[model samples]
Target: MAETLATYEVPEHHVKMYTANVQAALNKEGGILTPLVSSNAYTGEKSQVVNFIGEVEFVERSTPYGDTKVTELEHTQVWISGREYDCAVFIDRLDTLKMIYDPTNPYVERFREAAARKMDEIIMSKFFADRKVGKDGTSTSAFGSANTVVHGNTGLTVAKLRSLRKLIKKRHVKVRTVRPKIAVTAEDVDNLLGEVAVTSADYAAIKPLVDGEVSSFMGFDFIPYEDNGGTSGDGKSIPSFQDSGSVVRQLPVWVPDGMHFGQWDGLTIKISDRADKNHIKQIHGTFTAGATRLEEGKVFQVQSKNAA
Candidate 1:
C-alpha cells in the first residue's frame, strides 16, 4: 500500500530519522563495472563527502645511527579502545527526496534509479569526491566523473549464451517494507527519529537568528591513550567529548536520534535527475548496520562493530 507523508512540514518537536541498510552487495577490483555507493541521503547531481576516518598513533623505534624516525599510521580501530570517530553530516540544499506513486509516471519502471544515483552521489561526495559545482556549474570530481569509471569495455562481448551464464546476473534494488515512507529530512529538524549524521554548528549564539534556533546538538567520545604506560597502544580512560563544542572532542557523525517507534523510513533518497536508463551500477552503505537493521535501542551503546 502507498504511504502518505506530510507536505514538506517540519514537526515542531520531531526529528527526522533516515537509516540506510548499507551492504557491499557486489564489489569488483578490476572495475569491469562502475561502483556507486548508495544511500538515500545524497543528491544525484554531485558527489558525497567520503571521509577516511581513523586515529593516529606513534611507536618508539630506534634507527641504525641511534636516531628514531617516529612514524605515524592511522588506526581504524578507535572502537576497540572505546573511542568514537570525529565525523559530521552535512546536507545539500540541491538534492531532493520525493515519493513517486503516480502510475503514469514513466520513472517507476526503472526501479528507483534516480534514488540510487542520489545515494551514489551522496557517498561519493563524502567518501570519494568532495563537491561538484560552482556558480557556472562545473564538475568538481578530482579526476572528474569519468575518472570514477576506471574500466570501460569498448567492444560488446561476443560469447555463447551457455558460456555467459556465470558472468550475467540480475540487477535490481528492492527495499521491502509493508509501508513505503522512505523519506529524509534536513539536519535542522530537531528531535529527529531514527539515526543521524551530526556535525558542529559554528556557534555564534550571541547573534542569534530570528526565525529558527539550532537544536540537535550532537557529538561523540573515545578513550584515547598515549604510550602512557602499557606497551600495547593502551590508551588511558578518557572523557566522552565526541564532536560538539570545538573542544578536543570526538566528532561522532552517526548520532542516533529520537525513539525508533512507528513505521520507520530506513533509507533516504535525494533525487536530482530522472534516470531513464536501463543499465544500473550502485554503491551503498549504512552506519554500523552490516546486513542488519540497527535496533533503535542499540544506538546509545558502545558495542557492536556493525561492518561486513
Candidate 2:
C-alpha cells in the first residue's frame, strides 16, 4: 500500500532559528586569517577587485618652480572571487514538527557541527594554498613548497618570535604601530609553549607558563586553531604543520586587514519539502565565500621543524 505524500513548509521562524544556531557555532571557532583580511559583502557571483595601498616614493623638490609632478597614489589590486558551499541534511518526517518546537533537537546540533567544520575547512584550505611559506624562510614574495622551519628542535620560542618581527619589518610591513598576530595549531602550541622546565628560572619567572596558560607572547596575540583534516578543492587532504612532518606547514603571522581578502555573499538558508519524494524532508544552507592572500609579504608562514 503506497502512503499519500504531502509537502510540509517549514515556518519562517524555524528557518531563522536554524540559521542563528549555525552562525553562532561558526563564530565560536574564531578566525585566524579572516579577522586580519579585507572583506566585503557582495551580491552577484562575478569577479570583484579589491584594492590595497602600495609603496610610493617621495617627489624631489626642483629648484625651478615647475608644475608639481602629478604622481598618482600607488595602489595594487587583487581580484576577489568565491565559490559556493551547500550542505543538506535529511530529517525524519515523524520528527519534523518536533524540530520546529524544540530548538535543542539533536539533529539540529549535528547539522550545525557539520556545517561549521566544513566552513573552517574551506577557509583554511585556501589559506594553506594562498599563503604558503617557501623553502627559504627569508623570501618575502609568494607561496611555495613548505621548506622553511621557524625553530629547529626548540619549536616556537621567544627568539623565534623576535625573528618573525624582524622578517615582517624587512618586508616593509609596518608592525611598530599595529602589532601583528601569530596563529598556531594545537600541535604547535603543545610543542612550543605547552612544556616548561620546572627547575628553570624562566618557568619560575612567568606564572602563565608555569600554569600552562599562554595567551599573549612578545607583543603579539597567540591564537590556537586546530588544523583541518578534511579535503581541499583539489581533493587532497589538508596538510598539517607539526614537528617532523613531511610537509612542514604551520601557523602564520599576519597583520590585521593586511594580506588576505574574503569575498562573501554570506550564508542563506532555504527549506523545501517537495524534493526527495516527500518521504524525506530537507534543510539546506548555502554560502558563497572565498579567500585569497592579497599581499604575499603581509602573511608569513613558519614550519614546525628546523629546515635541515
Candidate 3:
C-alpha cells in the first residue's frame, strides 16, 4: 500500500478564524480614520445620501400673532458612492504542506493594512476635493480658500496652528464643543518638536521632544499619519503643490462632523478552492466604502513643507 498525504483543503473553522483575524487587524491597525469621522451604513444600493438642514431664523413676535411667520426648511445633501476594493492570495497545496508555518496570517494582515490605508486616503482627498451638494446632488462646490493656511515656506509650526485655530474660530465653531483634528506626517511632528515654543516648559505643559510625539496641543487633536499613498489623478497622498521651487504639503485639518464615511459592505473574507487554478486555496478580503467632506466651513487645509 502507498502512503497518502493529508489534503490542505480549507475547513469551516479555519475560514471563521481567518475572517476574525483580518477584522481584528483592521480594527486595531487599519482604522485610524474610521472612528474619527461621521459614519453611515447602507444596503441594497451603491450610493448613500447625508442630509443637512440650514438654520432657521427666530424673529421676535412683536405683534404676538401677526400673520404667523412662515419659513421653509432648507435642505442640502451630499452623496457618497461606494467603491469595491479587494485583495487576495493563493497558496498551492503542495507548497502549504511543504512550509513549516502557515502563510495565511501574513496575507490577512496585508489585506487589512491595505484596506485601512485606502480608507484614510479617501478621507484625506475629500478634505479639499469638490463636494456634491444641493437637493439632487447635481451641484459641485469648491473648498473655500479662506479656510486655507499657506505654507510660507515652512513646516508645521505653532504659528500655523494658531492660524488654523483662528480660521475655525472665525467661522464661529465652538472649539470646546466640537474638538478639531489635524493629520500630520512624522516630518511635521519633528518640525514642531524642533520649535523652541513646543519644547520650552513656559509654552507647553508636556515636553514634546522627550515624548517624541505630539498627542494634543493648540486646541487640536493630532493624528500621526505616515502613509503617503497619493490621491487619485495626481497620485500625491498629501496634497502638494510647487511654491517658489519648493514642494509644499497640504495637511488636512477638520472637525469630525465635517467628513462622512459610508459603507455598503463591511470588511469580509472568503476562503475557497480555485478550480480553474489547479485547486489552489485562495484567501480573499473585500469591502465597499466611500468618504466625502460634509462641509467646507468645517474643513481646512494647512500648507507646510514636505521636509523640515
Per-model TM-score, in order, reads 0.18, 0.72, 0.83
Off by over 4 Å in 1: 1-50, 53-67, 72-114, 120-141, 144-308
242-278: candidate 2 lDDT, tens digit per residue? 5554445465666766554454666677666745454
Worst 10 residues of 1 by lDDT: 77-86
Candidate 3 residue pairs that clash: 230-236, 230-237
Candidate 3 TM-score to native: 0.83
Residue 96's lDDT in candidate 2: 57
- Global CA lDDT of candidate 2, please? 0.57
Model 2 lDDT at residue 211: 41
| Maximum-TM-score candidate | 3
What does the lDDT read for residue 130 in candidate 3? 80
lDDT of 1 by residue, 176-256 (tens): 211111111121121121122232232322112212322212111111111112221111111122222221211111111
* lDDT digits (tens) for residues 1-308 of candidate 3: 43212346556766776677777777777666777998888777776677566557886777965888777765667877788878877765444423312335466667777888778767776777787787667888888889999888789888999989988999877798888988777677767767855456624632442444546777788877664545432322667777767768788888888888887757787877677876666777788987888876788889888553
Model 1 C-alpha RMSD vs. true structure (Å) is 26.2
How well does candidate 2 score on lDDT at residue 168?
76
- CA shift at 36, candidate 1, in angstroms? 5.8
53, model 3: CA deviation in Å? Answer: 2.5
